[model samples]
Target: EADTCIADTAVVEVVPLDMTVADSTVVECDSVAEVVVEPVDFSLVDSVEVVEAVDNPSEIRLNWDDVNYIERNTSLGGILDVIVLGDNTEYVGYIIRNNPVSGIRFKTLDNKVHMLKWDDIVIYSRRPLDPEKSILSQSPLISTYTFAGLKPLEGLIVEQDYETGLITIETADGSVQRNSARITNITNRPNENLYTPKRKTTKRRAVY
Candidate 1:
């Protein structure tokens, strides 16, 4: 036989078991219960801070060493202008290696590979090529006035060695080298000096 219990208006069947029910209680409801939920504050949560983006994130400012490192790794090579410290012989070619033991190796325009010791090189310059500047254009005859009582060499400047303070000029006869310290001034064109002195002006005094 089965027993019956009333849960509000619905009848619930109670099955007989080998267990005893003590202090049994029942509550009656007439309607569906409504839940009241309190709103949670999200202001206490930590937010991620955003940084200002740069215009060029991947763009790099490369130094001479950085350029060498990149070129060594890429093996593509780049143009280099170098001068020998002893003989002052100028060479222009594509630098291929940065060897410490064998020295710097480069390929010349004539398809010749040459290696020179770092100590043997005085001027090692690498710059971006400008299409506007060319040797084919007519250059002014530069005359370098020397502090020493010597005849000034008038020709086109081939290169200016800042490290050794020497200027190489190309003349009709051959290349000539001059010490920058010995030269006082360089005149490119007559009446149009390369460097001009500032004009002195008299200051007016206020009457007391």
Candidate 2:
């Protein structure tokens, strides 16, 4: 026969699982999942380069081509009345009346006044009679060159003349001596007496 047994105390204990099993259990039992996202592609993008405009140099240049400073002499269209003082042989000088001014006159080869104009007059010396021996042929004889622009009875002389006084107030349309005595003041008139020969050829021989 068996003997009867009695009595006692109780104890509780826990067991751990393998590492791979534990990792697998954590992944499978997770309540939420994680994911990695990528950026989207675009059809058009912002430009990186800047563009500038250019200007033309010719548009800013200045022009100053004009002919305003030139002076032109036009004929007034009237008969230029002139007087021949002496014969061609011994014509040293002449006394001119009705001159545009109170001075002597000389002519050029082309019939144009050389130093004087229609408004001015010149009293020039004559060419030498003998060209072979004397150099006087080449000399200039313009003793007095005056103009109406000068003060009345006032004249400028390159050389002095003893026959007549330097300051001779004269009438514009009268004889020299008569005008001299009656001279009081200067007159402003366009009429002038040019001692230059009416024909240009008359002075050609003297120029050479």
Candidate 3:
């Protein structure tokens, strides 16, 4: 009777069940996506090289003493690598041949020619004249020479070749002169007006 009473007092509970599906992706063998991941080079990120300073050929540093040094040494037809003091204008040129005119014919590094005779055209340089380039030595004067006790033709000498002893004289501007095969004393002009006049006796001889 106690077991029946316990069974009648026990209550039965029923539970309802429901089913749900999670969404999924469908993959086909032929349509499978390929994700290609290339290997990254970590060394490239830190491979930057240090840049070095380069020197400029045209731009130079110079002082007043350096300029004074150049001014003291620069001469006719002297080749110098230089720059203007205040303006820093650079040039590779010469003082040029002593122009019959007063100016300097400065053949520039660029081949453009100029004259440095302007009183305002100030310049500076540290380099000396090149001994090998552009004849810098003073040439021998042909007029100062004598041929066998004969003086040179007056005001006629222009240039002379020291190697061959050949002499050149200024003739017509564009004409060539033919020289005689031999130079002789026959060409020498006689010295005129060499005699002095005698003064007449001004006083009697001591009154005897």
Candidate 4:
């Protein structure tokens, strides 16, 4: 009778074996479903990275001084970066004016004025003249440069006298006087639009 009872207990345990197999199959199905969803999560992460890349440019800030704090000694001429032709000598100072007797008058930051001749100067501009840029101007008081390679200096025409063939230019940093013979072209400024006004705008919340 004891041996018969032991055999009956073993037969009962067999039912649980089939249930364990069914539970294992369910677990495998769930794992496969999770694997499919994992790719979607990865895609979402990739999309966020792309959005960050696109928005990064908007976050960048550029800084520049609106007014020059350096005290200017000489009243005439704009601050210009000048490069001489032969020695390629570079200078940063006030180009006072084009002197009919002396040439291109320049005053150094140290307060010494120089007469840079028409033939000697390679280029002069507020910044160094880029050799690879389209030169455009809209001033009636045009003073053509003697050298073809020299870029035309565009600024406010402060003074003009056809009799002396002298034209005075009040540059951003200083003043310049040039002969009409050096001037290639001329256009009238009926509206007197020499300088274009520029306004800067930013996102209101970004100001702080």
Candidate 5:
């Protein structure tokens, strides 16, 4: 007959059956409540493999590297997922992916996977076709004259004759009116000059 249990603090001694309450004290209270309430297992430690950010050939400068990944499973945290591999029309810049736990970042636009560094992911390559809008069309007219020297004149005459000089040409119509008139070679052969000028001389001297 053994039964002694008086509550209100300290007095308990009642053992009637076999006892067993030890799994390392419930695994030490679940490892002290998982070390005071879990939540800190971010992995993926490193990766910046942007093989080519381009424009470094003729050299305006822009190259990138850093693809190191071997820390698998610390719970696999943020960032670190950059896979921008070559020729987005030969590249431009800005592919800095990183987030080893809220260092927050990502890239790529016209190629997708956006929204992290979201400065619009910055990726543009398709602008090189403006050689002045395909050039060819400019003639607003300003001439020193040369369509073969603007040739066109048959019987041209204007004279101030004192002995035939200020312009004169009477090769036909019973000739006799000429001061070696060649008016610049008669606009390149106007019907080979078969002139017909019976009189075109006006000289009204003295107006001073």
Candidate 6:
């Protein structure tokens, strides 16, 4: 014997998820209905996108029979502190341009510009902590790429050989460009607090 809604007037619908919205919301219905929510604009104001990189250091290491994956980050030598997609949209980058079939261009650090489409990439790199091994013995190299026969980008250039978990690509064009992707996971996690580019120290004394 329980059934409520002896209709007189009813209209309640509130839908607005993500684009930042808040215009109206009031629900106390007795005989008055009017709920419409629609407002979305993910404004990336100023949109910093001025990418420019072509130095190509292409860091890598995590093969040697997997070598326990090693994990302990913080070696910004060529500067890549990268992290892509899978909800981990962190990119303090510099890959400039790695064409494995015309796809892969990252020049971020606020100055945005990220163009990745080797199937949107899943695991690019991770094998650091060996700059003479003194960052308190670092160890971190996970994700040995698992994209088998992944096609569509026409194989232009993709090289990530974490020792033996091979992945070499290059359809043509002097074919032999395998940066593959580096700085795999310099501590990737809801990351984005990067601005480490300040080093000017040189004090050498010799010539006797």
Best by lDDT: 1
Off by over 4 Å in 1: 1-80, 131-208
> Clashes per prediction?
0, 11, 0, 13, 1, 13
Residue lDDT tens for model 6, 27-74? 443655444555655543433444344333346665556453233223
Cα lDDT of model 4 by residue, 81-179, tens digit: 443444667666666565544566677667786667766655554432333421123322233334234566655554445345676665545677777
TM-score of 2: 0.18
Ranking by lDDT: 1, 4, 6, 3, 2, 5
Better of 3 and 5 by TM-score: 3
Q: Per-residue alpha-carbon lDDT of model 1 for 6-32, expressed as tens digits?
A: 345554444443332323334455643
- Residue by residue across 112-192, what tens digits does model 3's lDDT show? 766554342354332425456322122111122235544444323333332334544442232122232323422222112
Local distance difference test scores for all models = 0.51, 0.28, 0.36, 0.43, 0.27, 0.42
Superposed model 3: Cα runs more than 4 Å off: 1-86, 98-102, 126-208
**How well does each candidate superpose onto the true structure, as a TM-score?**
0.29, 0.18, 0.21, 0.27, 0.11, 0.18
The stretch of ten residues in a row with the least summed lDDT in candidate 2 is: 199-208
TM-score of structure candidate 4:
0.27
lDDT of 2 by residue, 1-208 (tens): 0222222221212234332111111123223333222223332423334443333212433332432222212232111213222232212322222233433343332455422332222222322233452222222221222344443432212222223433322222321222233334432222223223232222111111
RMSD of each: 23.2, 35.8, 37.8, 19.1, 41.4, 23.9
Residue 74 displacement (Å), model 2: 6.1
Worst 10 residues of 4 by lDDT: 35-44
Stretches of candidate 4 off by over 4 Å are 1-81, 128-184, 188-208
TM-score winner between candidates 1 and 5: 1
